[model samples]
Target: MQPVDLNPKRKKENPLVWIFEPLERDPEYSRERFFNFQAAYLDGLLYLAVASGEEPWNGLVVCTSHDRQAGLLEAFPVLAPHPVLGKWLYVSQRDPEFETVAHQMVKLARERDPRMGVVPGKRKRSPDVIEMKSSSRKKKSW
Candidate 1:
């Protein structure tokens, strides 16, 4: 095995974050790191996410319901269904219109559009979990 350098390297900032920065305008806007992306929420609903990775993971993921996906696609023609996550939409970082579409997605989220947001994880079933889940307003960790 090759020698491994275990020293922690200072991580670079996620370049995609600029897309959803505008969402901060909302008083209720909050964000938490979800995997390699940052999950943006309004009030308590997760809306937009910025991903920085390879291929499909390196893009902006629009987390919304299937019913609303069609309307969102109509409004933003540049977006396409994420290959791995067909239910939602995605705009690759390399797309020419990536920035514009990202901003629009944020706008929709800021407007509290129904198309944005999806329950993060499993619904709370147990009482203890339910109480804790409601307190933070986040369903659960992925």
Candidate 2:
């Protein structure tokens, strides 16, 4: 039996990491795991993500504002509005032009295209979870 390398450094990288290589060359570029996806950011603005999961989410998520959607769509018709999250556009990995569009997006991002990214929204805690935390902090009366 082969022993798996328990060393964290040797862990397999995300398969889609290469698609964002253009932006990775910049000092401001950053990457993080968002939910089940791999999100790429430039100067803290999320530009795109590699979502390799179930259907709708199994592709690239181009994080742009509504006003810019039309232009991106016009430029790359292979992309479309995400089924569940209509606000963001998506390019399915199953699409034939996925690789081409991915490269083009990375190029635009590398050039610091104004329409490529958005200021990520802060994640809000659930009301019930906050209430539970507050209750736990209080001294219990018998």
Candidate 3:
């Protein structure tokens, strides 16, 4: 039997529910929408991304640093480098064991595996650029 619906707004036909529901249980896990896709974070570090973009690109994305790439590949043999996400790994839904591997990755994330992710570098922005963006939002004094 299907699980009882926790959210009235979420449709029963939505396929992405399986992706978000499990991650929400982790206290440190959070998500933000990046245009058409959802970026999943763990302890503020982006670890997984779920997007239905195109063939080979649409599915679970494992965001890992260069150092952890080899180790992660060893864990999830089905994963490959995403075309747009640069160093991130993409596991397509076409894989026969997609659900199994995705669940395994989530479990590894919950366990706080060192191979799951890396601390992203801070974005560099000049003070003038920041001020310009913020000042534009302020109403001009007549």
Candidate 4:
């Protein structure tokens, strides 16, 4: 993704477009059964951040709906310290509003330091499957 031009005028021209690059990539990993679990986990955190009135720069977590018909969306905070940026950041799967929040985050980062750019890092993959074993039956119990 192109770096966001922090100039107010330029930012206004396309406030959310800069986030597209990061959002478009496939997630770090994927598992079919755990998709909702992953989304809900991230969403829960974002909700807390929004409710707490924490600065978005502290890091934001966003979750998009897996079900096409559900249309659900959520956001939260990530408390982990950024390796180089040294600030908390929200991480989430790609979604329609990713660009909007990303633009805002870029603006916030610039406010802290003009030289700071998007901190490149590897994405964490979600597990692809969960195995649940059925309890063995005892003949006596039956």
Question: Which candidate leads in TM-score?
Answer: 2
**Candidate 4: stretches off by over 4 Å:** 1-88, 113-142
Q: Model 2 has how many clashing residue pairs?
A: 0
Best model per lDDT? 2
Evaluate model 2: give its lDDT: 0.86
Clashes of 1: 0
Please report how far candidate 2 places residue 133 from its true position, in Å. 3.3
Give me the runs in candidate 2 sitting further than 4 Å from their true place. Answer: 1-13, 135-142
Across residues 13-93, which tens digit of lDDT does each residue of candidate 1 receive?
Answer: 788787767877778888878767888877777787878899999989999878888888988888988898888799998
Q: Deviation in angstroms for 137 in model 4?
A: 63
Deviation from truth (RMSD, Å), model 3: 6.1
TM-score of 2: 0.84
The model with the greater TM-score, 2 or 4, is 2
Give a tens-digit lDDT track for model 4, residues 1-142.
Answer: 9997777754122222233333224343121112112121111121112111224332333221123112111222222332332333343323355446655543433233322222223455544422222233324454
lDDT for each residue of candidate 3 in 39-132, tens digit (9 for 90 to 100): 7788988777677657755688887876778888886788877777768888887778888888888877777788777666666889999999
**Candidate 3: misplaced stretches above 4 Å?**
1-14, 120-142
Q: After superposition, how far is residue 73 of candidate 3 from its true place, in Å?
A: 0.9
Q: Estimate each model's TM-score.
A: 0.76, 0.84, 0.71, 0.21
